[model samples]
Target: MIEVKEIEKKYGRKKILKGVSFTANKGEITCLIGLNGVGKTTILNAIMALTPINKGQILIDGEPLKEKTFEKITFIPDAITMLPQMKIAEAMEFMKDFYTCWNQDRATELLGFFRLNKDDRISSLSKGNTAKVNLLLGLALDVDYVLMDEPFSGIDMFSREEIANVFTSHLIENRGVIITTHEIGDIEHLIDKVVLIDNGLVTKEFNAEEARENEGKSVIDVMREVYIG
Candidate 1:
């Protein structure tokens, strides 16, 4: 499980996260939802310790994040970081050399799962396939938790659907996932918990299935009430 407790963050005088807290249990997909600059990305960054928090704590599986903890978790940023000139197979090699946790067989499986050719150059791949490669690199890591920032952004609908399918597939089974996106239309069925953030604070947090079963509220239904009412 990934636990974020009362986290506070500041950029100069601007506070980004104000007393934010949430829990993402293993085998569940937790989504952090908000509009632009509402501190959704900041929370992911804080969890990975890419940015320091001002106060409070973040823990993974009951322990605070440490250098060794990185082996147990991986972060897939909003965009790919590798050089665009590299071929897909070469890119996989890069991961193998860099990360001891890289699983070649699993990467090969994901390569097929995404319907991508190993020989295709990154620069020539479609936006959707590029995103798949980015995700595959992270997912191929033998880790327990995955943090994805806007996996569906800037992609075609079919591509977004393909990405969403991975959440339900055996590839990600039993692995904890925390994803961030401004829009929830594509992944409404894939998420287990929704944490809504506004004005740099958590406005609401609820189980998606519970909300529907008990209140007859869809994610958008609840969002409409939170943001509009």
Candidate 2:
């Protein structure tokens, strides 16, 4: 499990995350839902230690965040991390050389799953294909947790559907996943927990199933109450 307690962050004088807190458990998908610039990505960055925090604690399976702990958690940012000029195969080799946990078989499988060609240049691929490559790079890693920032953003409908299919597939099973996105419809059924954020604060956290079966609410319904009402 990953626990984030009272995290605070600022960029110069502008506050990004103000008292953000949440927990992501193993074998479940925890989603951070909010509008753009509400610090959703900042919260994920804090969890990965990619961005410095002003105040807070982040724990992974009861241990404080550290270099070794990072090995067990994979973070895929929204932007393309790989060099634009690099080919897909070269990017695979780069990941293999850097991370001890890199799995060649899994990478190969995802390459086929995403219908991506090894010889294809990252810069030459379409926007949707580029997103798939980004996703494949992260999902191929052998890790206990995955943190994704806007995996569904800026993609075509078919690409979005393909990516969402991955959630139900064995690729993501039994691994704790924390995804931040404002587009909730595509993944509404796959997520186990939803943490709603607004104005740099976590406004609500609840189990998705309980919200439907017990409270009779869909994710969008809850969103309307939180953001609209």
Candidate 3:
């Protein structure tokens, strides 16, 4: 499991995360849901160690995050990370050289699943295609945990549907996932847990099935109570 304890982060003097805490268990999809600019992405960044935190710690299976630990956890950021000048095939090679966990067969499978051509230049792909490429890069890694930031943001309907389908496929089975997004409807049925955040604070955490079976509330209903009520 990934454990985040009292995580605090700041930019200059402005604080972003204020004592945030949560756990993403293995074999489940844990979602961080909140409005824009509420430090959802910041939390994911802190987990990946892409951003420095002022106080607190993140642990994977009771161990502090390190270079070797990254092999087990993969993060897909909100924006494209690859150089636009590179072709899809070159991007694959770049990942191959960097991470020992890169799986070429999985990459090839995702390329077919996303209908992406290796000859296509990253700069020439549509917004949705670029998103697919980003997803492919992460999904191809043979990791236990996958952290994603807004994988469904600013894409077309078909692309959104396709990406959602991937969540239910065997590709992600048995792997833990932490995804931060305001677009919860797409994966509401697929998520196992929900962590609601607001104004840099983690307000609630609960099992999705329990919320429905015991309380008769869906994720949207819980979101309304946290963000609206």
Candidate 4:
């Protein structure tokens, strides 16, 4: 399990995350949902230790992040980190060299799943395909947990559909997943938990299926209450 306890982040005098707390268990899809500029990405960064927190603690499977614990997780940012000149195959090779957890078989499977060509240069792909490559690289890692920052943003609907399908696939089974998104209409059915944020604070955190089964409300219905009221 990944636990974030009373975490806070600040930029200059402005606080971005104000005592945010949440827990994401393995084998469940946990989503951090909020409008843009509301510190959703910052929370993901804090979990990855990519950004420093002002106060509070983050524990991965009960231990703090360090050189050894770092290997247990992976973060896939909104944008691809590879050079445009690099081919898809080359980018996979780059990951292979950098992380011991890189799995070539999974990478190969994802390449085929996304219908992407390994020989194509990163600069030549469309926005949807580019997003696919970015996702492919991260999901290829055999880490225990995966944190994604807006995997469905700014892409074609078909591409978004394809990417969303990966969530239901066995590719992510039995692993902890923390994904951030402002849009949850397409993925509400795919997530186990939703942590709602507003003004850097967690407004609500509830099980998506439970919300429906018990309250007869969709995730968006609850969002309307939080963001509108």
In order, what lDDT does every prediction score? Answer: 0.93, 0.91, 0.93, 0.93
RMSD of each: 1.2, 1.0, 0.9, 1.1
Instruction: Write down the TM-score of every candidate.
Output: 0.96, 0.97, 0.97, 0.97
Off by over 4 Å in 4: none
lDDT per residue as tens, model 1, 32-142 = 999988999989999999999999999999999888898899999988867899999999999999888899999999998899999999999888989999999999999
In TM-score terms, candidate 3 sits at: 0.97
Candidate 2 per-residue C-alpha lDDT over 1-229 given as tens digits, one digit per residue, 9 for 90 to 100: 9999999999999888899888999999999999999999888888888888999899999988888876799999887789999999999999999888899999999988888999999999999999999998898889999999999999999998899989999999999999999879878999999999998899999999999999899989998998889
lDDT of 3 by residue, 71-188 (tens): 8999999778899999999999999999999999999999999999999999999999999999999999999999999989999999999999889997799999999988688788
Q: Check candidate 4 and list the clashing pairs.
A: none
- TM-score for predicted model 4 compared with the true structure: 0.97
Q: Write the per-residue lDDT of candidate 4 for residues 45-109, one digit (tens) a residue.
A: 88888899999999999999998665689988998989999999999999999889999999999
lDDT of 3: 0.93
Q: lDDT value for candidate 4?
A: 0.93
lDDT of 3 at 12: 83
